[model samples]
Target: MPIDHLNPPTGAMADNVIGFARALRKAGLPIGPGAAIDALAALQLIEIGKRADVYATLEAIFVKRHEHALIFHQAFDLFFRAEEDWKQMLDSVPLPDDARRKPPPASRRVQEAMAQPLKGEEREAPQEQEIKLSVSDREVLQKKDFAQMSAAEIAEVTRAIATMRLPQAELRTRRTRPDRQGVRLDLRRTLRASLRTGGDIVDIRRLGLIDKPAPIVALLDISGSMSEYTRLFLHFLHAITDARKRVSVFLFGTRLTNVTRALRARDPDEALASCTASVEDWAGGTRISASLHNFNKLWGRRVLGQGAIVLLISDGLEREADSQLAFEMDRLHRSCRKLIWLNPLLRFDGFEPKAQGIKMMLPHVDEFRPVHNLTSIDGLIKALSAPTSGHHGPLIRPAA
Candidate 1:
C-alpha cells in the first residue's frame, strides 16, 4: 500500500513528512518509503506539537547505526525547524571570527539535502549562470586534511581509499622452489631424472629462494590527539587487510587492543563499526609506553617474524615517557624488518622531535613520515616500495 493511503495524514503534514524523507535520502541516509510510512504511523501515537516527541519519532524510524546519528541530528534540525530560524542559527558566527566561520562536519551535507527539491513539489526556476568546467573535485580533495573534511568528503575519501592498492614488495625467505637457473642444484632430482634417460643425464633441477610479502603489523594510536588520523588509517588498513592476508592491526589509547579480526570485515563501515564496539579507550588518554611494552611482550614475536614491517601510526605524545618506552621501542625495532613511524604532526613545516616521547621513539624508527592527507599516504606507499638503506640511526641535532 502507498504510504499516503495509510492513516491519510492532512495534506500539509504529509507533504512535509515526505519532503523531509527526501531530504534525508539526499543527505546519504538509507530512508525508504517504508520508513516514511512508519514515521507517519509513529507520529499518530505522540503529540506532534511536542518537539522532543517528534524528534524521537523520526530518529527511531530513520537511524540504524551509531555513526549515522550526527547526520540524522543535523538533517532533523534543518528539516523540521523553521526555515528562518535555521538560517539565522547557521549564520551566527562565534568569536575568534575565523574559527567560528567554518561549518561543522555534518552541516555541509545537511545544507545540500535541504536545497534539494522534493518530488512533485513546485520549484522556482534556477537563475541563468555560466558553467565553467575544470579539474575534477576529487583531485582537489586528495590534498585536503582528514581533520578538516566534512561527512560527504569523508565518504568520498573512504571510497577512494578502499580502491587504493598497496605496493607488493616481496621479501626473500629460506624456503626454496625448483628453477632451471637456480643457485643451488638438486642432486637427488638430477639423479632420479637421469635414470629415466637410461643413466644419461639430460637435465638438472635447481632450487632458488622463495619470496613473499612481509607481514604488516600496524600499531595505531586512538588517543584524543590522534583520533582524526586514526579513523582514516583504519580505513586504509581495512583495504590492505582485504587485499593481503598477513596484515594485523592494533588500536592503542590507554591500552592495546588487537583489532585485526574486526578490520577483516569486507565492508569498511561494518569494519569500523566492529572496531568501535571492540575498542573501549578510543579518544581517551595516551599511554604509548605501556602499549608498546605490551605489544613487545605479548605480540611482537608472533607477528614480527619473517621480515615483518611495522607501521607505527601516532603523534608520539606519550603520557608516560620513560626509559621503558625507549627500551620497548628498541625491542620492537629489532624484531621487525622495518619500523616506519607515521606521524600526522610531521605535516607542519617546522616540526621537530621536541616532545619527550617523540625524542625517545625517533632513534628507533627507520623512517619518519607524515600521514595527514592523501598525498602523504601516497608518499608512504612509495617509501614502502623502495628499498631502505639500513636504519637512519639516532636523531642528530644540527648546530645552531
Candidate 2:
C-alpha cells in the first residue's frame, strides 16, 4: 500500500503537525508539537516497509505519557493501515480483518458485568447516562487484567464517568449562627459591628456572609494496587466537579499529592493527561493513615468546608499498622458531614473487613462501598442518590 493512500504517514500536513497533534490529543494520545516533529523525523529515519514498524516508532513518542500509551496503540492500529478491508466491508459495516481485529480474550469477565445492570433503568438523567460500571473482584484471579484492557475501553469508561452527575444532593441546615448571606443576622457579630454605630442608635445592619460551600472532600488512593481503579475514580471526580463545583481531588500513595486543578480541564483526555503529568507517585505503596493525617492537617480547612463529606478511597493496607491510623480516622470522621470509605477489596464475594488497616478504617467510615469494577461505580451513583436506602451492605459478588 502506497503511503498517500494510507494517510501518507501524515505528509505535507507535516507542516500542519499541530493539527495532527490536536487529532492525536483528541484520540487520547498525549501529543504535542515537539513530539509531532519527532514523529515526522523518526518516520524519515526508520524503514517504513511494514506498517507495524512505522507505528511502533510513532507510538514511542505519543505513549511517553503512561496513561496515553494504551490509547495511542489502539487509535494507531485502527486509524492507519486501513487496508481494503474497512472499505471492502463498508457495505457490511463489519469489523476489521483478523490481523487488525481481535476478539475479547477468553478471560473476559462477561459474567461479572452480567450479574447486574450496574445502573438500573430507573434513574433517567441525561448527563448521567454514561455511568455504566464494571465490577471489582476482591480476589482478582486474572493477571494483566486492567493492564490488558485497550485504551478505547478505558476511554469509554472515562467519558462515561466524566459526564456523570449526582441528581440528589439535597442540602440540609446543620446549625445556624447568623451571618451576612444567610437567613438570620448574627446577634453577636451584628451587635459587635453595631457597637461601632453607638449601640445602633440609627439603622442597624449585619455584615459578613457565613454560608458554606456545600459539603464534600475526596481523598483518593492512587497506589500501585489501586492504580487502575484510582485512574477511573479521577474521571469520576471530574464528572463530580461539573456536577458540584469546586470539588477537590487528593491522590495518595507513599505520600499525598493534590491534582484537583489538573482534573478540572474542560476536556476529559486533556484533563487526564494533565493529571498524569502532575503526579510522580503513580504506582507506589499505600499509606492511608499518613495520607489522612496530611490531609487532615493541610487540606482539612480549605476544602473541608460546611461539614464536608470526606471520601477516603483506598484499600486498608497500611505498610505499618500503627495506631495513628485510628487517630487520623477519628479526626477525619469528626471533621466532616459523613466519612465514606471506598475500598476496591469490598468487591470480593467473601470479603470481610479482615486487614488491621481495613478494620481500623471501617469503623471510621459512615458508609463503605467497593470501587473495583464498573458495576461498583454505578452502584456508587445509586448510593449517592438515595443514601438512606436499606440496601446498603448487600454484597453481590461477581461470579467467574
Candidate 3:
C-alpha cells in the first residue's frame, strides 16, 4: 500500500493539502479550512509513503457523507498521482475525451477541480492561437441531461431548481371567506353590524369562495433505470415541498414508500439521506403495477384529495405490467385534478410509448412531458400553470 514510488512532501505540502481541500469543496464536498488543517496535522503522525495511510487520513478529515466518497476518491487520485510537483502535474494533465464517452459525474468534477490553479499560484497563459466562439456555459448546462452533469454542474442545477417558483394559480374551495367584491351577500354579518345603528344597515357584507394552492402529489420511481433521474427529481421535490404546504412525495420501486416527512428536512442532503435510509429499495427492480395498486388502495384517498396534481415521475418500464396497472392509473387519474406523467425516456427525440407499462398508463394521464433536464422541468411548470384541453387525448398510440 505504500507509495514509495513518489517522494515525500516538501515545505509546500501544507499549501498543496489546502489546495486539494478547496478542490473537493468546489466539487460539492463539505471540506473546509479546519478539515484541511486537521488533514495536514494528521499526515505528520503517519508515513506519507504509505498511500493507504494518506488516503485514510484525508478521508477521515474530509468526507462527511457516503455519497461524497466517490468525489473525494477521484479528486485525491488526480491531485496526488504526480511524482513531481503537484501544480506542474495538474497543468500538464490532459482533459478527458468527452466526445467519445462522458466521464462519470465525480470524475468530471475532479478534472475541473484539478484544472484550477492553487492559491498563490498563477496559471500559465495559453499560447496565442486561433479562437472560435462557443455557446455560453449556462446555455449548455440547460440542455445537458441531468445524468450527464458533473457534480459541480449538478450543484449549480440544484441551486437553480431551488429558486424556481411554481405558478400561484389557486383552486376554488367550498369554504367561504370575507370579501368586499364577493357575489354572495352575508346577511348575518350585515345584521350583526347594524345593531349599533338600531337596525340601520350602513354597508352590505359579502363572502366569496376560499381559494388554496392545488396540492402536489409526486409518485417517483426508483428502479434501476430511473436511479439517476430520481435523485435530481427528489431535489426538485424538496424545493417544491419547502415552497408549499400541501406537497406529498412517494417513492416506488418494488413497493411504495411514503417519503413526505423525510423530504421535509430543510437541508437537501439531509433530506435525501433520510429518504435513502427509510426506503428499503433504492435502485431495485420495478413493480409498477403492484406499487400503483398499493398507492391507489391505501394512499389514494388521503394524499390525492383537495384538487391534487399528481406528478408521476417514471420510465414506465414495469416488470409486472398487467391490466391492474391500467386500472390503478385510471383510478389515480380520476382522484386528482391533473395527472401529469413526467417521463425521462421522452428526452429521446424518437421516443414512443411502446412499452407495455407506458401503453397501459398513457391513456389515463392528462398530459405527458419530458423531465430529463432543467428546460423540461420549466416546461412542466408552464404546463401546470396553463393546462390545455385535449393535450394528449385518447386515440394517441405509440409508433409501431
The clash numbers for all candidates, in the given order, read: 0, 8, 0
Estimate, for each residue in 39-117, the C-alpha lDDT of model 3 and write its tens digit. Answer: 7777777766666567777888898887676667678777776425544423433333321243244465468667777
lDDT, candidate 1, 62-150, per-residue tens: 88876576677777766654444333323332223322243344466578678765546343321111011113565677778899998
Please state the error at residue 54 of candidate 3 in Å.
22
Stretches of model 1 off by over 4 angstroms after superposition:
1-135, 387-400
Q: List the residue pairs that clash in candidate 2.
A: 133-374, 133-375, 134-373, 134-374, 134-375, 135-373, 135-374, 136-373
- Model 2 Cα lDDT, one tens digit per residue, 1-400: 4322333345333533344355456554456666776766666665645455555666675666654544454444444423333223223322234324432221112122122221226324422433332335222312223434566466455555665777634344455544445655456665777677888734344444333334557788888888888777877877777767757888888888888888877556557777777878888888888888898899888877665666778888888777899999988877766667778776566887678887776666677777765666767677555433231233233221
Worst 10 residues of 3 by lDDT: 125-134
| lDDT scores of the candidates, listed in order | 0.77, 0.61, 0.77
RMSD to the hidden true structure, all candidates: 9.9, 13.2, 9.8
Comparing 2 and 3 by lDDT, which wins?
3
lDDT of 1 at 68: 70
What RMSD value applies to candidate 3? 9.8
| Quality of model 2 by C-alpha lDDT | 0.61
Candidate 3: regions farther than 4 A off: 1-135, 387-400
